[model samples]
Target: MLMYCEDPSSFCSLVLNITSATGNFIGNQLDLLYLGWVASLLYPAILVFIILPSLILVLLYISAFLLYIYMRRKKVYNVLNETLHRDPWASGRYLISLLWDAHGYIWHGYEVRGLENLPDEGPCLIIYYHGAIPIDIYYLVARTILTKGRLIHCVGDRFLEKVPGWKVILEAFHITPGTITSCVQTLSENNILSISPGGVREAQFSDHNYQLMWGNRTGFAKVAIESKSPVVPLFTENLREAFRTVSWPQRLWIALYEKLRFPIAPIYGGFPVKLRAHLGEPIYHREGETVEELAQRIRASLNSLIQRKQKLPGNILRALLARFYEPTKNE
Candidate 1:
């Protein structure tokens, strides 16, 4: 089956907001949860991605909104005039994950493969290619948790750790500092941890070839080895098409961002592009492998996954025009 985006109408057009609000019509499906349960999930995404003008506040607002709705409609929360209330990390993270899943299915046509490879129970290290926005990580966690019933301790960049909004969400997800200590701790505790070895560099520099800038980043492997965790290589296809990085002066842009904290390289595109995440079999600890050697093993696995699922997410106009012109040429 073929799928591609179409030009918007001259007047009205399909947009993400309209697509998000489409949930209001699915009240019946939500009703199965009852108002409290449903509110717990929907309110967080709405408040976070919509209202707070930020992300972390989403955790608290989700609870408050759900409570208010439950009390008014179902009568609940009995708590006071609350400015803020922190929730269990799991609760907030679960809500955000659910939103990503819904959005992935309804908007991006997201798909995941190879779940049988994950360990039945134990700390596992998951490494993947990074995208400009990294929403694909959310998609992965959302689906993995639902299918595998496990929460992954994802790692984030130093820059995102500073974004006040992302700071909260990242912390709630057990992603912090991107340091060896945190990574080792996550895996040592027998919890799955996910990190993108390519990190911000790849996120900013990716191109048509799906380049991964994880050069010399072997610390993740060292940590995994120290924790005796198996490494799972994963890659989500079509990230480059989802958000194309700006070319020319790319290095200069990254330099300025590092020195001045201004966002650079100016990438765009969050369209409903198709996404396929490939999860590879675990690379268990090797007795004598160095950190670099172990990292290379994971990298090779990830590259294999990327190569297998990679596609251009072709231009809609180009595909249509070529099709229309095909028969004429043959004739």
Candidate 2:
């Protein structure tokens, strides 16, 4: 029976010859079916263990290739900026152009409204309500480059200087906040200067509700007064939605990170999201304005602009649609 079973055709012939042999033949067939079922279940496990890692490696390779292309283009710009010692404003504009071109014109998402209102040439203090993420600075930089080819001296947190390669890049961009004297000098040079009064505190506490972290942003007004630069009130539409903040508990934990002088809030918005930046009418500084009064007025102007921009139906629709597209511009 065992030998006959090994050769199934012979077993079937023998089973036809004897009815009792049919039961043994049926049992053997059932055992074979059971074995095939067991093998089918285990086959997928073997393939996953042996093949998945290789597939992941291939994906990693593709990602690396894209990153290499991005880095190489950026390196060329850096070399050009260094070799030419280009005018600061021109250099900034060139960089923005390079980034925009590389990213396939992502900056077009911005529906700029007040370019006509920006001065053709002058010293100005541009105060924009900052987004929770740092992309707001990039948008401001891009706009400045587009209009005047002038670099805006951005006052960033002191901690940014501590980052390894970031320090050198920030310095190249003429970003400095180490001292009031340096700030004053930059402003005196007729270079545009931008400040986000909310700073790190706003980034940490702004939550994802589109609320401004600014309670009373007096420092920017004071800077405007000291520097004698006219205040430009800028507003960004859908900037916060570009990078949503994490949960409140996570934000609280991040608020405790001390490597930075302030809390290191984790920014959650990035690729596949659209952002828009807009410049409002410039709020000219009053000659005899006290710092407190100027600050109040600047805040009021920014809030009003925010409310107006937010109410625009087109802006709101674009903001929602931006969630699906990757940003190509500096922001």
Candidate 3:
């Protein structure tokens, strides 16, 4: 009896310890119950509030992208068709050119030299800096036709296709969008193609500072390289004064106008101002040059040309009276 009684107390203590451990394990589950309940409440709210809105935004972005592609395709097709339509009035551009020539002569006593610098034949990529209203384009086109007898197709802004009167004007001038494909075709066919890499932003923001606004626009270099064409850099003076762009509600308004492809700028004096244009020596592309390097080279060339325009001697009043008093060939 004594031998069995000695271990009975120790055995009783072990049994009590096991009971205490089992009770604490059940108590820990009760403590976690509140946290589990909170997670269940939050999971549904997060899915409905945060995840749902993000999904809707994603869908909207996709829709907008598809719409932009469709409109761009439609515009390209229409422009190609218009290009095929021949202008029966071969002298149409000639008359228009004369008008601008007279206008430039009267206004700013405009003088555009360097017609000799342009090649007498095709496949020339006429890359120029955009002035206030691209008055340079008109001056050069008219002068080339009047002087060299070559028609130049300018690469216009994407917004031109949507302009009220500009659609007709674009078709008449054989202008197309500045897409890579268009440039390639224009150059390969040995046609004179003029492009402004800076485009509308450059035109809108110019304040007689002939700085190149072509931000990272290197595609033109690729086109020129692939076409194996000589690039002709050209620029003009006092273009901003001729027809200055006006802006109201500056930033927000301009941003909205851009989205809609609508330019909303208040225009000031047009015509009868001092005008000047200069065509630079043609820059030939070396084989295997990177587009970035070529673009920088082109930018440097245009800047040099603009700096020269500043040095030329010009008198507004005398040049104006000289042109206004002269008789037209028709007269």
Overall lDDT per candidate, in order of appearance: 0.71, 0.65, 0.71
Q: Write the per-residue lDDT of candidate 2 for residues 1-331, one digit (tens) a residue.
A: 4424556468676776576677789999999999999989988987798678778977775675566447656654664567454354445446654464334234234445675655666677777776667775676565556445566778888778877788656866777763556666677778777787877776766643455667765767767777787888877666666665555576455547544466555666554344556677777678787989888888888878877665332233455566565433332
TM for candidate 1 is: 0.67
Better of 1 and 2 by TM-score: 1
Cα lDDT tens digits, model 1, 147-166, are: 57588777776666667777
lDDT of 3 by residue, 1-331 (tens): 2223245469766776677798898788877887899888998999899899889977775675555444445533543355434554345565566666554544456677676777788788878877657876887787787667688889887777876787766776788886898789887988788988888777776554556789888988888898988888888755555666665556864686678765566556565665667778888888778889999999999988777654333233432443445323233
Report the CA-based lDDT of candidate 3 relative to the real structure. 0.71
Of the candidates numbered 2 and 3, which has the greater lDDT value?
3
Clashes of each: 3, 5, 7
Winner on TM-score (2 vs 3): 2
TM-score of each: 0.67, 0.65, 0.64
Error of 3 at 24 (Å): 99
